[model samples]
Target chain A: AQSVTQLDSQVPVFEEAPVELRCNYSSSVSVYLFWYVQYPNQGLQLLLKYLSGSTLVESINGFEAEFNKSQTSFHLRKPSVHISDTAEYFCAASSGGYNKLIFGAGTRLAVHP
Target chain B: EPEVTQTPSHQVTQMGQEVILRCVPISNHLYFYWYRQILGQKVEFLVSFYNNEISEKSEIFDDQFSVERPDGSNFTLKIRSTKLEDSAMYFCASSDGQGMSIQYFGAGTRLSVL
Candidate 1:
């Protein structure tokens, strides 16, 4: 079985400050990693994904995550954040041909002005 | 931008009543899935359907729950007998292929079992 662990349950940052949300996984086989953001009363939106190529993957919204093989981590980072960036973020991992996704408990990001 | 659509954004039903949630995935996608999130909890996978059959399902998808693709565009999830615990936000998703692994999600159906 594959599982995702997001170490932080809540992260509060001032607007325009940098932040990082840590995520780790436990999988016996190769896996795919993804970050999803959920705003209030809205569905989840894919922030970015790490399939295989480069170790670092980026999202159009200025967020990026680096896939660390040895550490089994896929931590999301942003150089600067805005109030609109406040939302619930989830880290997920999938294996076995990507048919299933195991998600973390989720991290709530609060960006204050 | 093609987006998944779900009907009855919110439904309120008494316990033991039957309820069906509907979804219309992207026109070209093949794989469809259902997930549920209880208040203050992580999202949990319920089932996955492909080629008009169930490809995978979690233990939460028991005899009380079933999915059907009644037509080309509509996918439905039926709960035979709802329980108070069944109250949650149910999300429908679809993906075009198995490799890319990017699933597009609907706004979700909020089921409130009273």
Candidate 2:
């Protein structure tokens, strides 16, 4: 079965500091990788996705992830993070077209002042 | 941006009682899905609906659970008999099912099975 792994359970960083949330996925078939963010008391929101073409994908909020097939990872990174970025980040992968997404346990990012 | 909508942000039910969680997916989306997340657990997919039928389902969606698109707008998940383990945050999501298949999720209905 396809699965996702988020190595870091929690990451704390000072505001405006660089941070990375590690995510890895395992799937026998080709997969579509995605990064979703969930704010407090809110639903999952799409941060970015890697379908094809570029090896790296960027979200509007300065977050980006690279698709590295050799490493089986799609790690989310931001050079500078804000306090608003504090939330639960989930890494997910879906195989083929329109399949169910396999999600990681999630990484909680805490941005401090 | 359009968003999926779910009714009754929270639901409380006793063990062995039946409950229905309702969702209104984005109007133009072709695929709808149900996912659940236990507190501090990974989000788990329960079922996916498309074209008035179930396209895919996970083992967690057993005989005790059923999904229905009773009307043009409402998609519902009915639990025949709720269990303590069934207490979780139920999320409804939908995607256009086009090229990328980016799904948009709604604020979930937190189901509390007492």
Candidate 3:
């Protein structure tokens, strides 16, 4: 079975500061990784994905994540964040050609102004 | 950009009552999926539909759950005899069914069972 684990349940950071949300996964075969963000009362939106390419993938919103195969980790990072960046972030994985994704419990990023 | 749309932003109902959640996937997409997230829980896959039929379903999707693409654009999930545990935010998503295609999600419907 495949599973995703997000290390932090809550991460608080000041505005304009950097932030990182840790995620790890356990899968026997090759996998596709994704990071999604959910704003208050909104559906999840894809932030970035790693299917097959460079280990580091970036989103238009200045967020990036690196897929580390050796450590089985895909951690999300941002050089600087704004108050508008506060949201719940989820790490997900899919394997075996099935589109169904197994998601992590999620990390709540709270940007304090 | 195209996006998935769902109806009834929120629904409240009794435990034994049946509920049908509706979704209109992106017009050109060929795959549809349903997922739910209970409060404080991770989002979970319920079912995936293709070619007007179910191609895959999770253990959480049982006999009480059914999906239909009754028309050219509308997809629906019907839950017969809802349970208290059914309370959650249900999301509808769509994809092009291509390899590594990303699924676009709808705003989701919050179901409150009493």
Candidate 4:
């Protein structure tokens, strides 16, 4: 069984401030990590994913996440946030062989201008 | 940039009523899935369909739940008898040939069982 844990339920940050949303996972087999963002009343949009290769992955919108194998963590970060960045972020994981994604309770990022 | 589409963005039904949520996945995608998110809860996978058959289902997908791909373009999830607890947002997603591919999601159907 695989499970994901997102440490913060809500995060408030000022515009241009750095922020991090922490996620951790546990799985018996190799896993793939993903970050999805949901705007109000909208569907989830894939932000970035860490399948293999580099330990770090980045999204087009300035969000990045690093996959730490030893720490069992995949924490999303943004060097600077904008008001438009406010949204619900979900951390998810799946075992390599299947498409089933185990999602963590979402973290709501509230960016203030 | 094709995307998944779901119908009846909001549904309100009395308890014990049957509800069918519909989805039209990306045209070329082969894998389909259904997931739900209760208010203030994490999203949970309900079932996955591939090759006109169910590939995997979570514990929450009991006998009361069923899925079908009645036509080449449409996929549907049926809840035989919904209870108040069944009120949630149902999301439909689809992905191309799978190993680590990202799944595209629909806007979701909000089912409200009263």
True contacts kept of each: 0.52, 0.73, 0.64, 0.75
Candidate 3 on B10-98: residue-level lDDT in tens?
Answer: 99999999999999999988989999999999999999999878999999999999999999999999999999999999999998878
| 3 versus 4: better DockQ goes to | 4
RMSD of each: 1.0, 0.9, 1.1, 1.0
Off by over 4 Å in 4: none
Candidate 1: docking tier = medium
- TM-scores, all candidates, are 0.98, 0.98, 0.97, 0.97
Docking class of 2: medium
Model 3's DockQ score: 0.69
TM-score between candidate 4 chain A and the true chain A? 0.97
Which ranges in model 1 have alpha carbons more than 4 Å from their true place? Answer: A96-98
| lDDT (tens digit, per residue) of candidate 3 on A66-110 | 999999999999999999999999999988343788899999999
Error of 4 at B114 (Å): 1.3
Q: Chain B of model 4: TM-score?
A: 0.97
Q: Which stretches of candidate 3 lie over 4 Å from their true place?
A: A96-98
Residue-level lDDT tens digits of model 1 in A72-92: 999999999999999999999
DockQ of each: 0.63, 0.78, 0.69, 0.73
